[model samples]
Target chain A: MSAMIKVNLDLLLVQRKMTLTELADEVGITLANLSILKRGKARAIRFSTLAAICKALNCEPGDLLELDKEAE
Target chain B: MSVITIMLPALLLYVAVIVWLFVHFKSKIFSVRSGTASTTDNRLTRLVYHFLDFFLMFIILVLLMMPPLLVVMTISQFDNPEWGIDIGVFSNLRIDLNEFAGLVMEPSGIRNPEFSTQAVISIDTYSLFAYYLFALISVIGGVVLLYILLQLRTVFASLLSDMALTPENSGRIRKIGYAVIVWSLVNPFLQYFGGRAVLRDIAFNVPGFQLNPAFEIPIVGLFTGLVIIVLSGVLNEAARIQKDQELTI
Candidate 1:
């Protein structure tokens, strides 16, 4: 099975009209951490952290992330 | 005082706590049944809450057993001074390789070498075997518990994505995250204090070995705990927003 297409968190935030600065402040995460998450470079995400991000952005995790077929 | 006495009271207190949780939750269940006001149709919430309750019960049981385990180790060291094969004399204690090996190996044997000592203590090989088995079980149990919690998080996130984010839910999630962070911060300290106390009691017998409690105070535990809680919150919020957007579309 192909690896799932992960969410582009940065794009999601932009589409939701949420500034990175605002999201970072609301999530209580360092700007650096938020940057890492947006860039999809984070090694892992905790359930709680994901929940906070969703709550702040007013979006579902699936909206930010999705499963898609990998290129052959 | 032996470990048993301490454990008896602790066990009773733990049981009381468990009973209180049950009663409180049970009352909630009754209200849910009788009350005309119901908001959500999700059975997953109930499942998650029940899972949390069960996990807490297991944690309490593990906590209850810790003192007895420490006491057993202490008594074992005392009976077998040679059990602690000193590697060197760091401070007043004798440091020996054999003793260190014995600490990990025949821990109980080093304590009560005589068959006349309590049957459980005297059977050192069996005791070690049992300990190894229990440790394995505990590790597996922890892994399974973590997996279940993760699953619950996924479910919560999915459900939240479908709903609008009310101020009440937001506040509740924040409070839960704070509680989790606090618990994580305190846990290591408690473990260190408890471990140090047990080790100090046995230090007289294990001459070379020192109990290092310094590693317990860093923000590592709290950080991880906070991250987990925050992630859960993010997922729920994301779910809610996504749902609202879909409805709008």
Candidate 2:
């Protein structure tokens, strides 16, 4: 069974009531990158980017990511 | 020397290389091995790359004999043994074999002795044009090789700094693969025609020993071409992955 690293960026963005563009601008990243993270397509997330994202949303790393144990 | 003797080691080498490749990439065949793409270049590495580029250019020049007078000079050496000139550069040169075609090994009349039956061929006279015909066939094959090497030069140039995942590099590699496969497919038939041309109208003085001409397929070249094409696909994937990783942050 293959375990996927799932992204919860969309949930945190919703709870924070922040648009993707607003988060992108505040984090100095592109909306495209946020979109990729939201869609679980990004192969990796850097610590700096993760820290910026956490600061913007006021969430821990666990709040933005999950271990998807379902076989895919 | 017989063709089999010359080819035995080459075939073995090919098998060994294939085995080594499989072993080397056992589980990572699908995954591109990861390492930091260093921007640093030592002087020695740069010098080696430059030297290789020049060597390739020189080889292409050698393959492109405008008048193919090299063939004439080679045949001349055969005619005049006193010349004893070394023909190392043009190792692929084909000499005339028309008039000297009366070659056949007779089965020993008695039980095969420890010493094999001696059937030495001593050529006294032969047609000169036969050499030209064979050499011409070889030259055509060389032309295809020349194209492959030229494309490879472009590849090396492109890969010096940038990776080999560019559209131009992909196109060049595909073209080289096609050219190599074409050369492999056509080489044997060229030999067949060359053999027939030389074998035609040739009289045999020996009673029962007409030497059968042996021709070979370019297995090594064909395999290499296939491998290059496969690697080109891998390179394209690697390029895509690289782009994805860059945007992952």
Candidate 3:
């Protein structure tokens, strides 16, 4: 199986013009978890929470996450 | 006629149907597979199982409805002097014309008869039929539910043994648990409302038990049953999630 793509929450927030603190507060997610999510280090995201974040940021899920092929 | 004369044949038919269905499907459901490649085959098997499950539920509903339908028919056909004599331990139990008339009239006149000649206001034949029907359905439903629970236990064990759980599967299990919980909560309320209406129509007056004035009162028995089912689902989901977490670690 191909390597699964990781989310880029920081890039998503930057594109949406939302600060880390603002996004974290709006999404009801902890600052630490938000930081981990921004750095693409989080293991998983719940679809419900993903939807909430998407709504809060006015961005689609694809804008926050994508798949990339691992280097050979 | 002996009670066994009527009950025995019905019992035999019930046993035969249950046995035949179990024997025919047991092997198909429990058969070991060589490879895990065929998603199509798995889906087909699941579809078949679901169909059988629904059929069994339908049988239960029919069994339940039979008595009420019979009773309604009997009540419609009820006549004034519809009594039959039955030989018992203490002479013949008789429902004579005068006794029947007395019972029908005594409710208005307020004179309690002596213990020996205490007129038994016989239940309408249809009502008796309905009582028996409900009793039979309750017994059968209880037994079938127990059997299904046992089958679920075995299937869950086998599935756990054969496969490693994933987060996706765990999520699916949780969703199933939620569905069961919702069904459990709703089923009893529906049954209770239906039952309460029927009882009211029949003018049922049990000595100790009284229906609450509030129509919105929850059916506690149904709620308890639902709680049990939802708990089982929650436990299964928890187990799946634990397995997934262990696998991830």
Candidate 4:
């Protein structure tokens, strides 16, 4: 109840040297939606979308998502 | 008062309410920019909705005119004393038509049978009042029904494209079902009142003219309302699932 998942998509993109727009295009999602996900405002991410993002960024799901146990 | 005088104000009131609703829901109505590109591949379903759109409009026109028409026709009969109103009193009367059939078969025996066998009553002032009352009830009921149909048209127009289950559409469907149920419950009382109004001044002791509340329950309407209510539930569930699926991406 006190835990929440956070997206480290910005960090992953930085490490992968990929632009947000480029990642959005490669993942076949709108830039606005991608920004929402990157800003950690999304309620949940579909596994398929996460997989697509991971594939586009050349990273694992753990590299993009993080568990913030104390954020809540 | 005359039927037209009684009906005109009610008609105007109904129109005002419709206009108010349109103004209130203007944003929602305008926001429906979706085309008729339905998600379903069934051509038959598309055709049915297309037909319904026109049919609903025609029904609205007929409903609007019916009360006035009834009044006019009745007044004509009232004015002409020679052609008295032929009020049919129906019940479980078992008239043996076997003799009439035999007489008709034999041309020589088939003398001009008395067409005045049924009572032809003069339209008195009380009967005219009764007719007006009946027409008023019918008009009000019709206007309410028409209002619901117009609302339904708006709902359908908005969701013309991809009528996939949504919260708005589900709510509309639920409202329609509830409206129908209310109409069904109210209709019996209206029928009883109208029947009483018609029979209030008839001098003859007609069998079915008793001032009793013998209105039959509108079983078909009840069934339709239940079906729509169930459909609304199904639509809501479908909408939830669709949202989840869309999020699943």
Candidate 5:
């Protein structure tokens, strides 16, 4: 079974009217590394980083990550 | 006259290479001063390192041309009316004086009539071929090791900028380690065959004399390679950790 973790970070950022650069600064992470996470290329996310990102965006972890079982 | 004709060009070329390397390193010394001081920053160490680098390269270049030289030498030996072949596998071995005495004590009928045990040994074509083949292998191994060292010089140059722990440098270290291990593994056999080739002309006809091949194992060389391989892994891990830290925020 093919599985992919879809990051809804962009959607949350847009809802919060926050740019990736601002989120990265609040989360204390590099823009490039944050972009990697945002693009779903990260194999696994650290709980601390996830916590920081969710805190920065004022959102829950579930709102940021979801398992996509079906694809077009 | 023919020897002079052949050697003069080679001699002139070697001198040119030496001059060029000296100038190249001398120019590099100025640039190196602008960079951060490395482990090999001092004038003496740089001089020794560059000298060794150039010397190894010269040796490797000479070695690369050995197959042709061996062919010519083998042909000359073959054409030499004074020396003839001492055939058989035993012809490639060295026998001791005790073994000679023992051989003489053996039954006279058992000895070959043609092989005069007391004859002065001169290399035969077949032995030269074998010698050249093994020596060529050893030389190739040396060439690979020298090339790895040359690459390491670049890695060290990068180190002067305090950027020594990159993936590329770590990979170069691993390559050097691997090259050393390979050379160490092949060297013993090369020594054995090379020794045999060198002694190709000495006929060991001592009655009952047996032959033994000499072996030279590079245990220290093997250990050095293994240590370098481990250090490369450590460097790679350190680089990874540094990248993670840089990405952390």
Candidate 6:
């Protein structure tokens, strides 16, 4: 089964006009980890991390993450 | 003269250490800390852990050397009358100590000896190997136990940091539990072999001591292993809950 929750970190980063590194520095996370989150490679992301990312990018959780309806 | 001089100080030190530990544990920092991970508690835990690690390392060293030491010491006594064992001393290779104290205290050349009764022990390459085999098996068991302890230490460390419900820790616990169970199952065979190794060779004229090759199965170890494995399922569920908690935004 494919992942139902899709990370829209790239779109949010683009909308904020920010580099992943810059967001990482602002969010107090490593650039490598930010890259993973942006690439949707992370198994799951922490709420605190997502909150920090949302806070840094001046966006809501919905803007950064979206739920793909589960496939039948 | 030498044994008394050396032993007196050593015995005094041993008693002192035991008393100190009793007092230390009875004192405030080691015992009274109740609620959570205080700095003092962490320090105490680390001190205990460091001591355990050091002691285990020392035991491992002794275990590693046991087989060869047993073979050499046992084989050395083949020609020596009274079957005395050598204690390696500084600048001396052959510092022999007899099992019975009367032999050591008395002057050479027996003039009306009190203890004439001899306890004869038969030894061949097979018997020596048997003894070596027992020590080697003990060493192997001890090494495996140490490996399990290392894994346990990791799990315990994670628990201390409040990461007890991680999937990695669950796996480590499961593996340790299984290792313990396996060791328990295998213990009887090792015990049997160890006892059988030297049991037949020893013919006792001395009273109050009996050698028996009784199989010792570790029922407690097996039970403990089972309990841990069963409890790991709860940890697995807790890990899932933690993962869900993490995923919540």
TM (chain A) per model: 0.78, 0.89, 0.81, 0.89, 0.90, 0.86
> Deviation in angstroms for B162 in model 2?
3.5
**True-structure lDDT of candidate 1:** 0.53
Residue lDDT tens for model 3, B23-94: 765665666455665476565655455455545554564565556544443444344355322211111122
| lDDT for predicted candidate 2 compared with the true structure | 0.63
* Candidate 2 residue runs with Cα over 4 Å from true position: A1-72, B1-48, B63-128
Q: lDDT tens digits, residues B1-249, model 4?
A: 555665576568668756755665455434432454545543444454454555565567567667666655666455455543333221112223343664445445545532322222323343566656655666777776776776676566555556547888888888889889889998777766655556555554543222232456789999999999999999899997877655433
Q: List the residue pairs that clash in candidate 4.
A: none
TM-score of each predicted structure versus truth: 0.32, 0.52, 0.32, 0.64, 0.59, 0.54
- In model 6 chain A, where is the ten-residue run with the lowest total lDDT? A1-10
Off by over 4 Å in 1: A1-72, B1-46, B49-95, B98-164, B212-214, B217-220, B232-249
Model 2: CAPRI class: acceptable
Which of the predicted structures, 1 or 5, would earn the higher TM-score when compared with the native?
5
iRMSD (Å), candidate 6: 4.8
Worst 10 residues of 3 chain B by lDDT: B84-93
- Tens-digit lDDT track for model 1 on A2-71? 1254657777777888888988899887888777666654545678888888898788888876665563
lDDT of 6 by residue, B104-189 (tens): 57557756333432222233333444555655676778887887877777876775676778989888888889998998888667
Query: Using DockQ as the measure, which candidate wins?
Result: 2
lDDT tens readout by residue for model 2, B1-249: 444554465557557755755565444333432464544463334444555555555555455533444444544355454543211111122223332345434445645322312122223324555555655675687677667767876777666655657756777887888888888888777665655555553564553334433356678989988988887777777777776676678
As for TM-score, the candidate ahead, 2 or 6, is 6
Interface RMSD of each: 12.6, 1.4, 6.1, 3.1, 4.2, 4.8
DockQ of each: 0.02, 0.42, 0.05, 0.24, 0.12, 0.12
Query: What are the lDDT figures for the candidates, one per model?
Result: 0.53, 0.63, 0.53, 0.65, 0.67, 0.65
Fnat per model, in the order given?
0.00, 0.62, 0.00, 0.24, 0.05, 0.14
Per-residue lDDT over A1-72 for candidate 3, one digit per residue giving the tens place of the 0 to 100 score: 212656777677778888989988998878777776666655567787789889998888898778866722
* Colliding residue pairs in candidate 5: B103-B207, B103-B208, B104-B207, B121-B201, B121-B202, B122-B201
lDDT at position B202, candidate 4: 58
